[model samples]
Target: MKKKKLLLTTALVGTMAFGATIPTSLAHDALGSDVNKGEERIVFSNEDLKTLESSLLKGRKNVGNFYEAAAVQIQELEGVQNNTADVYAHNGYAYLGTHTANGGNGGVRVFDLKDPSNPVEIAVFAHDVPYTWQEKVIVKSVNTPHFKGDLAAVSVQQTSRNNSSRPDSVGGVLLYDVTDPTDPQKLGFYQLDRRITGTHELYLTTQGNRALVLASSPYADYYTHGENEDFQIIDVSDPSNPEKLWGSDPRELEEISEKFNGYHWDAPDGHTRPVFNHSVITDNNGQYAYVSMWDLGTVIFDIQDPENPVYLGRTEYRDDQKGAAHSAALARGGNILIETREVSNPVGDGYEDAYGYTRILDIKDKTNPVLLSEFTTELTYDIPETSQGRTTFAKTVHDPKVHGNTLYLSYYSGGVIMVDITNPNNPTEIGRYTPESANVWGVFVDRNYVLASDMGQGLKVLARGNKVVNNGKGR
Candidate 1:
């Protein structure tokens, strides 16, 4: 008996085309780890074309219309490449990340949101690194002993697994001083091992006088062959001197093994479900950290002590559920959690019948979290029978943002769907803003309006029309 080995190969197609001179040593490496395994290669086979056509047709069918109670679009700023990734709003400005889907160099785009209806592009943080992409960016106002101003942390990842050994290739987090959004000054770069690829998602928090950055390195153990941890905490209290404070692999924890009885290592579907950290978010006080583990659910950690973190309990999924646990947000004074599962392939291997949706959990009991309820939209369960087994990225929920009792979600082609989670157990859809050709990747709620990052159409400023009443504190 022999073990099955999977090798990733890149096919030249559109702007994702690769060069003919692929290094032989790098050809056998896997594309990525966990949920993003083997996604870099853009092979345009017959089946691939069929899937693309199906997604486009589905988008067209539901295009150019808004829900009766839909939020009105105030303004839209087209992206430089129309390949926007994630968006973050702070103070009176909006920052957007760039993707490598169209062979464009990754960077951070800044816009002045002072005038909500008219966002002005103020600056662009050009990422000169070749063969890499910046998919996530988060800006936080810090008042530390060394640096006290606006700090931006951007996640950088290699575009392809085969280019790991290229001299020009780089992977890690880039820090910038954006206190002056118009002229962002480079502070420092936190470099990761080449084998680890890079950080896919990041979060910044201020623990007292010390500021820290929590980075999620997806499938790091698989790539390094158990040599490194996937989640890392870096002490960025001094923007110029970024140092690693702590690192941990959730799978190696005793409580995780005992709770699931080691079932996470080898799932019942005859496939090895590798546990990896997909994304992370911390409480307002930075006392606890919630990590979104792809197949092992969301693992909680107590980080009151920056040097040492204690393992808390994690969320659980049913036997029939394909565990993704992509991203999450905290609400209701950090007692409730909004978890979004990006299950792009939803109709095979005995999985559910629809795309990913929102799951509300009561985390008041950190040691033993409880599932309160689940929220789904028409696109989540209304997949056509013909597109059941085919993989499409257009219909799944990508991110979550909460303002008061309202929950905003980025539903790719399904557009932005809003829900009223006043009752955690029974969330109801209150509003939506679906554009003519929407491919929204992220959503952010501000004091006055909401900002959505659409991959194809760029930044869209939306008004909830007094629907969002600040009855409770928002995340």
Candidate 2:
């Protein structure tokens, strides 16, 4: 990987755009973080988009406690040439994924973070496959059968609703050799049939020498194919040649659907939707894979044997309950599971009173899962929720990540929230950062900084202010 030289120019403040120079003069204390104090390439520039600047100015005026100027705003990266989605930092490099924005192509942007304040973009990766929408990227080192070194996995989703429209429309996972951050070599591209909705979200784990990728195909379901799609697991032991290890049993669709009230269907876009897998994660030891099925609750799959996966147990929700089982993470030594729902559809009361928060499930027993509690931010009550098709960005819980006793979440427009889940029964919000023009898609709390990807803006680098206990978890 090669590093790029840093440049400096004047910036207007929270503006959005692709690739530009920002001077140190724009670095103000009001933004909450300390500027590097020298000529450097600021990751973000306000001069690019005046709207973003206005939003930041407004956000600063009425900042809340959790978001109150505690964390330092290290850097902001806008005009990255793509709409940022999920973000991952590894080996001094930040791999930022992209979403399908305005029919633009999706890919990943690699930034050299050796100099956090002056991060530089060294590479952009996109596959040559058709209907290829790369939204998420996961990187890890693999010592598999024939592969050993740094490997990156990215998701490929449907380019259009109908895969047949593009005969070569392929959707699945793409593996890459990212040993060198500047260059990502394609290892393998996995594709499912046109009938299935491609990979939406996924997770990667290493067991022994083989690498496993748990892919979430959220569009494949019983109503469409007469069977719900099981999250797929692939063995990338051989980076050049990947093989399907196992998948959820389609036969168990009706059984699980019945448990989740037979799939909560709502297609405001006029397209009849089906049940699907949204996210998949495994325990640290690779023993259990927690799969979150939208509207179907969470399903536990025993993956002790890489080649074989067995159904363990699942969570149950009620009809009157507001549920959108979207994604989850394991914590407390895999004894506790933190699940997040992705919905803001109004119920009887109206969008203003919609419910979409994080749920804590107890998986102490593999056979029976129990819901322990739920966590929500004050912003949920302050923001006005709207219908699914409407702009409910800041009203819903997008994702949750646990590091020690703290829970870092990315709320669409709510910015990034930090919660203290020390007590499983009572999760409290200790800190939060909601940008004025917030439209946060994903968040990752790194060793030295908190990384957030905003759909409307771009990447935000923040420091957990002195108010945070630091408890040595973020390291």
Q: Give the backbone clash total of model 2.
A: 16
lDDT of each: 0.69, 0.62
RMSD versus native structure for model 1: 10.4
Question: Which stretches in model 1 have alpha-carbon errors above 4 Å?
Answer: 1-82, 162-165, 255-264, 267-271, 387-389, 464-475
Per-residue C-alpha lDDT of model 1 across residues 250-316, encoded as one tens digit per residue: 4344433322221234544444454677899999999988998877778888888867777777777
Model 2 global lDDT (CA atoms, 0 to 1): 0.62
Cα shift from native, residue 316, model 2 (Å): 1.7
- Write the residue-wise lDDT of candidate 2 on 289-345 in tens digits: 888866556878778775666667776665345445777887799888898876554
Q: Model 2 reaches what TM-score against the true structure?
A: 0.77
* Residue 263 displacement in candidate 2 (angstroms): 6.0
| Candidate 1 collision pairs | none
RMSD of each: 10.4, 14.6
Lowest lDDT block of 10, candidate 2: 29-38
How many clashes in each candidate? 0, 16
Task: Report the alpha-carbon TM-score of model 1 versus the true structure.
Answer: 0.80
Query: Once model 1 is optimally superposed onto the true structure by TM-score, how far is the C-alpha of residue 98 displaced, in angstroms?
Result: 0.8
